[model samples]
Target: MEKKLNHLLADLVVEYHKLQSFHWYLKGYHFFDDHAKLEEYYDAIAEAVDTVAEDMLMLGFKPESTMKGFLSISSIEEAKNQEVTSVEAYEAVLADFKYLLDEVKGVKAAADESGDYLTSTKMDDYIEFFSKAIWMVGQEVR
Candidate 1:
């Protein structure tokens, strides 16, 4: 149970970092609008990361915060470049959101396998959020 929670928290850290990268590096004419929206979105994801890490700790698991830890546990790819155009950024985030939905689904499965109802519930909520965000982002692609 503790291990599963720790793994899920580690995945959250990776997603948080990607969102922050998107927020910082997004560019193009829609800069002001997209930048502000990305910041708001990333902030929410960061909060979720913190909450999940804290919950892991509460469950007596040491939450991993290092990049190495995230890389090891997360299926999501880290952002490789910061020079992406607005369209590229939007596409990248849409891809990340899809990846996140899959990761959250896996987390929920792990939680259920481990008999961790709370973690499973949280994963379900996150999956729903990411699924909706993916759909919204998809509409922005050209």
Candidate 2:
């Protein structure tokens, strides 16, 4: 369970940075609005990353905190030199948000199996937040 949580933390850290890239690189229609939206997403992801790390600490597990570490464990891929429009950015973010929710759900199940209600409850908050984010981003892309 600890390893799973650490893997999630790493992936989220990667996602948070990916949101930064999305904010920096997104162009085209709805630039300002999209930029602002990316900001909100990144900020929320940052908070979540911190929360995940703290949870790791609470469990006496050292959270992986490096790009190499994140890259190894993250199911989500980092954007390289790809240039994409705001629409593409939204699409990518929406997809990632969905992926993240899936991971959180899996983690919640593991937490339940281990009788870790605290972690499971944390995942509940994550599911709620990301589910809303997924809906909003989907609307943005469509």
Candidate 3:
């Protein structure tokens, strides 16, 4: 459970940074729309980052709060400095979310198996949000 939570926290942190990068570096026809939406996404990810860390603290485990720690453990890849189209960025976001969604589902399952309902419930919320985000972002991926 600790390992799962820590990995989730790290992925959230890395994904937040990637979203920021996309928000900053994105250009082309969808710039205005994608920029604003990426900002919104990153904001939500930022909140999730804090929430996961707090939950870890509540569970009496120290969260991995450093960039180094996050990069080391996160499965999500960091955004590159190269230029990319809005579609490409959106696709990248969708892919990351899909991957994270599966990971979160696993976390929730483990939490339930461990009888940690609080964490399980929290993961449910994350699952819902990610599912919606995946749908919305998928619309723009092509």
Per-residue alpha-carbon lDDT of candidate 2 for residues 50-132, written as tens digits (9 for 90 to 100): 99899888887898988888899888888766667888888889899999999999999999999988789999999999999
Off by over 4 Å in 1: 1-3
Candidate with the greatest lDDT versus the true structure: 3
RMSD of each: 2.0, 1.1, 0.8
Q: Candidates' TM-scores?
A: 0.85, 0.95, 0.97
- As for candidate 1, its clashing pairs are none
Runs of candidate 3 exceeding 4 Å displacement: none
Best by TM-score: 3
- 1-142, model 1: which lDDT tens digit per residue? 6665666666667767776787787778998988887777778788888888877876677888788877887766787656666788788788877877887788789888888887888888888889888888898895
lDDT of 1 at 55: 71
Q: How many backbone collisions does model 2 have?
A: 0
lDDT of each: 0.78, 0.89, 0.92
Error of 2 at 94 (Å): 1.2
**Steric clashes per prediction:** 0, 0, 0
